[model samples]
Target: MKHTIIFLFVFVFLQKGGLLAQSDGDNFLNNSVKTEHFELLQEFLSIPNDANYPEQITENINWLSDKFNELEFNTAILETEALPLFFAEKLINENLPTVLFYMHFDGQPVDLSKWDQESPYNPVVKMKKGEGWEKVENPDFKNLKEDWRIFARSASDDKGPIAMFLSALQVLQSQGMSPKFNIKVILDSMEEKGSPVLAPAVADHKSVLASDYLVVFDGPMHDSGLPTLLYGVRGITRLRLEVFGPSKPQHSGHFGNYAPNPVFRTAELLASMKDENGKVIIPGFYDGIEIDENAKKIMEAVPDDERGIRKRAGFAKPEQVGGNYQESIQYPSLSVLGIQSGWVGKETRTIVPDKVIVEMDIRTVPETNSNRLIELVRNHIEGQGFTVLD
Candidate 1:
């Protein structure tokens, strides 16, 4: 699987951090193990692991517990406020450093109407032929094709990686190989639904979950189709700026220009927040983020096809942020997720909206504090001659 390649880089990187044992991923992922891994993935995909349903989540936990138990990992169902977290650890020696692996067993709920297949859980192995996927008959297990995809819910989003990790353990077990460091695996039960119980659980079980490093094993895919090492992920902060106008919706035809539209006020406020080159104009938004020469060299090392990316995205020019795509994300980003002033489409309204609501999600980097960025936004809005209510 493509995700396996991504984990290769992750494993190698974690090895440096003493998270994983010193073993090349290439040597571990043999042909037979990969075949078995695919088989195991099919079984895992068979379980309907939508966290929305308690019963399904129970099944997923049981399956994971059984697998971990089989692998000789001491299994424990760690209790939490919500669904209990599944924990398994193998302590090789007391002196060795502990490396905790963070993984999510729960997947997003699937709508039957969206899939062409009989069921989302029932996976299909298909290969692209003339731009259309054609199911293979008696697929070659000896040599799995990299281009071939296993169509299933959470196949790549997360579950595939879990299967891959389990397969790696199986290979290691078969060869009587043991890691030097103490290994711990924490499987989150409610990660898909924003991990509501995680913080409380972590706080409560600090000693048990404590480790030298936390290795997260989740993501869709890297565009490069190569194992890319990401230094960090941008944290999120939400802001809903409500523009106040008349208490009730006024008749546009009657009031016309006389009635001040909250929509216009909101639009102008949003427009002032960003420049024409897609940079946030709010003071202190990009403060403290000073990319140095070393950062520039690291950014330049990423082999990105800038022209190809532009062609695929159907754009002519790139944003004038930090030279390239990899560099641009290094700075905090401001994105307007959604904005609503009045009803549209079939429910079109012909009146000036009473108030306008704009939702914005700011992607914060380690260089910037979320509170400072929010304060800057509030100050910027106030400077635009508008009263911000919280």
Candidate 2:
């Protein structure tokens, strides 16, 4: 019996020693992995990711596949009518809950003439020096600084976060540990263009995308520098209104008083939609919103610094739509985004324009009925003695 107890004690001691050794080994590996950044972000940024160009988007897909594959993730290129979605998942444990992470890979198309750099795809690292940035042609651990920014398309907009996430996977791999939960990532390729195929893709790949929770990692930081959790986002819709005038372009001198300038008519129509203080004049447009006492208190408490904002914007006074900027957005707004009349600037012309086009975008909240808002705008326009065209 004494011999049997000795054997059991030896086995237990060895088991405990093994666990401690593994823990120490993992800590050492993790500490050393600080230098491993998964994949060089410069290479990812070097690939043009404009979803409008399929060739550019395809190259990004291949790169995403290779990087995720290195981490032993099951990668799939989910097809859609537009650009394909890059989906990667690592099922570490069947019993663990699944998490779906959403990020976009596409970037806004670059206008080379407008960009200061040779190519938008070629990222430049720079450090801030006073009001301007000093170029850092090449960066290494010795020279890299925290304040240095990467000037490239999609660098901060998304690819930066993606690079960080990939590095996190590498850190876990180095430590010989799996993710606490099953991980799935969906990298959208057409997010800049409003993600047209996203809804259809969701419907078609419902089973593939099933998860306990979804986390979207693309958005701006809170103004207060505090982390924020968003419950919902406002929906957007646009309307283009074109008002025809003369059959053809007429000389402004010849028809200055005789011709009814469509530009002026269009201007009047737009002006009628809103009051002088910038409130939407269309009846019932803001009916759904209720500014309760609690909401007023919250709005009043926020330190928005309206005077500072006005100073930066070079405005002595602001439109009295709301008490402050934060409260203003709570109500639906009508804005004439752009008004096109005759050519100006270097292309100045003395002729009246054939037609005037006004572009508008509406932000919808949960309380607002989109159909009712549309009807109200339509009724207001008709009430102003204007023709309604489909």
lDDT of each: 0.80, 0.75
TM-score of each: 0.81, 0.80
RMSD, candidate 2, Å = 10.0
Error of 2 at 169 (Å): 2.4
Per-residue error (Å), model 2, residue 50: 2.3
Q: For model 2, what is the error of residue 263's alpha carbon versus the real structure, in angstroms, after optimal superposition?
A: 3.1
Cα displacement (Å) at residue 93, model 1: 2.2
What are the per-residue Cα lDDT tens digits for candidate 1 across 1-390?
643553474355345445444545545433434556678888999999898888998998899989999998999888887788889998889998889998898888898999867788999888888857887677765566777778899887688778878876776676555676788998888877768888898898889888997878887456676765455688877788788888989889987798899988788888898888988888878888888999899888887888888886889987776689889989999989778887898999799889988878888999889988889888998899987766
Error of model 1, residue 255, in angstroms: 6.6
Give model 2's TM-score versus the native structure.
Answer: 0.80
Kindly report which residue stretches of model 1 are placed more than 4 angstroms away from their true locations once superposed: 2-29, 49-55, 79-83, 108-119, 129-140, 192-196, 220-223, 242-264, 310-317, 340-357
lDDT string, candidate 2, 1-390, tens digits:
111222232222224334112333523432332323412667888999988899998999999999999999999999998888999999978888898999998999888887667788888777888867777765663334656777889887888768767765665566565555788999999988878899899899999999998988787544453445566666766677888889788998998787778999888998888887888878888887888888888878876677767875789887877777777878777766777877889999888778998888777888897777878888888898888887
